[model samples]
Target: MFDFVPTRSDGDALREYAELFRASFPDAGHLNETYLKWLYSENPSGKVVGFDAYAEGRLAAHYVTVPADVFIQGVRQRGLLSLNTATHPDFQGKGLFTELARRTYERGAELGFNFVYGVANANSTPGFIRKLGFQLVRPLDAKISLGHVAKVDWPAVCRTAAFRRQWTEAHLAWRARNPQNAIRFASNRDGVLTAFASTDKPGVVVAGEFSPDGPVTALPCASVPILPRLFIGLLPEASRRRGLAIDVPKALRPSPLNLIYLSLDQKQKTLPADQIALSFLDFDAY
Candidate 1:
């Protein structure tokens, strides 16, 4: 029989969890105690809700939900991002993952989390939908506009998107001040600062508020698009970029990814398929 614990209590469990993760996914980045503490304990939203299953006095399976404040149509909704899940190799087909998820989500709902979302890869997408009741939102595609953005006449516009982080002054400052990673800038006369993360590849815009003429072309950019605008894309880059390839009619595409969500609320809700947009900064991927 498996005994499930609701929270992580020691460094040994973390060490074992990291070992299992490394063994299961050889290419994944190393998750040390520091990073684990930073990610699971120190997120801006809230402490992560975790579940661990032990069989015969040994840790056998694990699941966790990382909390995030999701903004939809400018309204704040408390949500959890379903993060890393792992099972011991010896306990592969015992329905442990589903069991852990069910319990964790039950706890999540009690904690006032209304939804759980994640960018699902091919291997896990089917299982999440088929077994865990996760709904497929859409197949993620890259919106790569290579040319310079056209300046709109309006001073600023409201951000429009289904799933966005509620950006505060502190978050914006942290993102803009990062020297090694993404940097926000004002590209035009209006003071809206669009965000671009400098990568090995060309700079990718992770967060930007757009108008009818499209996203702002410059930075010191408008201080937060104040009024309701026509469009917004709220995607932060997920780590496994290999799966998301966007192919327009004439453009050659890379790989592709899919978005999925598990709603904790009783009422069924769906995302706006066409308006969905995200950036590398959105997920733990980049």
Candidate 2:
């Protein structure tokens, strides 16, 4: 039999949990104590939770939940951001993740969250689909519009301090980590960095970029309302053809931001089953 328990953010047990996470998701690269601390400490809404699985007195699996503020039809709604779920290699096929996820959902209900969200990759999508009954709701799409780039005011953009800081950090990180891809940022007159977008792949533009490290702030009114649209227009032509996939929110119809939708229950006949994958973000962990 296995033991499942909630973990707090202190002590050797938490340290062991962190180690297991690092080993399980190495592709995250540069995920250390500092990054995790930043995520928990700087979260604006203060909603984060964690669960750990134990077998034979050793930590074996883990999962976390984060609170996300999403906008639908101009109304802000709260969502449960499910992230960083992993099982130790030795413990695979034992249904540890499934059991823990069930518990997580129960906790989410108690906490008053309406829906759960995650970004799953190829390896774990099947389990989330077959076992957990999560459906594929959104597939990401990208489009490059060079005509929009020509209208941007580079001088005004550089003048804003907040925009400068966000641009500098985001651009440098993208260059170092994704040298081949392009990144862009936009600011309102009040100096708030209101808009950010990136192209991480050669011909793909991923918009809806934000500073992953801090809380989102309100931006000043744009002198030209179409600045955000212009930023999206700068994406490479080939990238426009190769769009990405994303999960859609339950209440909202498909738009640029919320493109996909998934249901945890299989009896609901809303979205197609085959194209979706289970997702968990690394940063959302407690």
> Could you tell me which 10 consecutive residues in candidate 1 have the lowest summed lDDT?
224-233
The TM-score leader among the candidates is 1
**How many collisions per candidate?**
29, 15
Residue-wise C-alpha lDDT for candidate 1, range 1-286, written one tens digit per residue: 9999895725776677777777666766546554566566656677789798999887788888888766655567888878888887888999999999999999999998988888777788899999888888887654444432223322212345566655454444443443334454444345434554443344343334322123433333333223221111333232112222233432333334577888788543777664444444455543
Q: Any idea what lDDT model 2 has? A: 0.45
Per-residue lDDT of 48 in model 2: 62
| Candidate lDDT values, in order | 0.61, 0.45
Once fitted onto the true fold, the runs of candidate 1 whose alpha carbons sit more than 4 angstroms away are 9-12, 143-160, 172-191, 196-255
TM-scores for candidates 1 onward, in order: 0.71, 0.57
